[model samples]
Target chain A: MSFAQPRYDGTSLALGQQSDEELMLAYAAGDLQAFCQLYEQHKNPLWRFFVRRGMATECAEELVQEVWQRVITSAPGYQPSARFTTWLYQIARNLLADQHRKAHRRFTLVSDESEALESMASQDYPDTITEQGRLALRLKHCLGKLPALQLDVFLLKEEAGLTMEQVATIMGAGLDACKSRWRYAVANLSKCIGMGAPADD
Target chain B: MTEEEKRLSALYQSLDKENSPEHVDARILAMAKQGALVHTVPLDVKQPSRWTAWRWPLSSVVSAALLVGILFFTTSPLLPPEEQAVSASSYDMVPSAPKQARREYQAMPEQKRQLAQSIEREAAAARSKTASVLPAAQISERLAEVDRLVASGELQQAGTLLMSLVEEAPEAKARLSEGQLALLQEALHRRSTNQ
Candidate 1:
């Protein structure tokens, strides 16, 4: 990301209250306990992050494995220059971009809003499908309909639980641009999912 | 955040229940364990090989010896000039340093040449300290003459010449090697005994 990265001041958190950066540093210094704890904390969020980006379950699993492998291999070189999540998501983002390039399936913005709505309308729901299942399916469809960049912003914010600044840092976009993309994603998804009309910008 | 945004976030949270499969978890955990084991063992708790155990002390001893050898070869007078040069050249030939260090070490031959030159200059300076008063050959000739004069029974003349030699080159006695001084003393003793 070309955005200005946050700097870590030398001041440390209190003992027994290590931040993600501390855990990473400990892991780098060969503390397996720290790494195990770190893996436990972020595994689900990272998994969901790949999954929500429309990766197949098998593909997402492979990517998850690959990301951890990268983290392990790169541990020796890791600096506490930015938040660990920002760094983690940045790796995930790069891998995702590489996968897209390899597959020649770079996600483009949906050309027609009606096509997304029509796709939603044509889906045949089983009689046994719960309301939650239907909503999740609709949400997945709307997410797919979004521009690749917008979906990235939304997933980073909602799935990774990153702030706008962290998202900007990870995405290499300006903070204002990140916020705008996030708003657009939310508005589009809100309208597509019939969540009581899209909120006014 | 707006009410609509909150609702969307809540909706997503409700549906975001997908966990990574147990097999994937096992695989990732296994990877992390392997990685941590590698990281810890290579640095924090590594078992040293035989070479690794000896590397530091051996390198230290070698470095100290090299430094002492360079100092002695460049400054010591007991070693002949040719031997000093040979020692300097031999030290230069040691291929112990790394590539970058060897690149720096490549300049060492020139430095050793300069050191050899400086040593030669010091030897010349010491020789000139004695030769400034009188030629070494003339001093030897005078000593031989004193011995001949003693044998010829010209004791007064031999004593006078020996005294003149001392007065003319007062510092010569200090500069002369032990063997040369012993020869001078023996001639003086012969002259005294003859007297």
Candidate 2:
């Protein structure tokens, strides 16, 4: 059976809402229930990360499975030096890299013409619209138009709620470089969405 | 600060407000159960033997017999006709000669040499194509340009140049290969290390 089937209940969700590191520690200590909770917490976001990055729905599903497989395989050896989300994102990033490399190698002839970023942009917009939807739509479009690195920095910072420091660590970039990319991403996104430069936080 | 900038920030904050989806919990639990089962079954299968003293040696004998049976089945085709005839005279010896021939084939120098040569040829062809497509001089020049920009403390310009170089080069689209795309990575690495 596909591992994509959901396995938790309302009570489990309530219990599983604990921080990732806590859940992971429990899982490492032989608490299968904790691992289930951790998986429940991350599956959708991880799925969306791949989905929004231009992976086909089937590929995204497979990637989600692979990500969890990695977690399962590595759990006994997992060290909680950072937040569990950080570790999870690190895995997601590696998987994304490998996927991109494989795709590049497979479609070497059509590499330039794939319009991956454009495809990703098209996939990110929601179907339904509300009163406040215009801005969200614009933001999604702007995010799609960003350079891949800048887009990743923006997504990790804003969507994932990672600190610039954590983003720098994840991206293997200097803090200043991360900050600079964030600034550029924000500025470019603003310009694309007909907004000016970002205000100082 | 412009009103537009404030609005954009507010918009971004709004986007970030969407909570993680509800179904993630269920998926996690399923995955955990699957993981537990994968890890638990092998131990369970081995548990009975550990509990019984006689069963352990009996299990070992059975395992060796099974191994020999498998070796005999897989290797019989490799035995010479004379060896096969001699092995056929006795049931136990029938399995042994074929297993020996298979083991010998596996360790044979000629087979290994042929495999190594094929792999080497494939690698050489791959290297040649990769080398031919990538103009080494052009890459070096771009690297030099990035170095010049960084040396002048034009960090933003260096970044832009690096980005442009990566865009222009098919190989550097991925972030992991930033070294091949630009010299900025080294400078950035040095700066971070200094910090």
Q: Which candidate leads in lDDT?
A: 1
lDDT of 1: 0.76
> How would you encode candidate 1's per-residue C-alpha lDDT over B1-195 as one tens digit per residue?
888789788778877568888899888878877877777665567788999999999999999999999999898777688767656654654476577766665666987756855675677677667554877888788777877886888766766677668667775566554544555676678768889
Quick one: how many clashes does candidate 1 have? Answer: 0
Model 2 chain A poorest 10 in a row by lDDT? A1-10
**Model 1 Cα lDDT, one tens digit per residue, A119-167:** 6645677879887777777887777667788888988888889999999
User: What do the candidate models score in CA lDDT, each in turn?
Assistant: 0.76, 0.62
Candidate 1 regions off by >4 Å? A1-16, A118-136, A196-201, B43-195
What digit string (tens of lDDT, one per residue) describes model 2 on residues B70-147? 999987766788545433443343355577765664465976745644565577667665543546567567767777
Chain A TM-scores of each predicted structure, in the order given, are 0.82, 0.73
Clashing pairs in 1: none
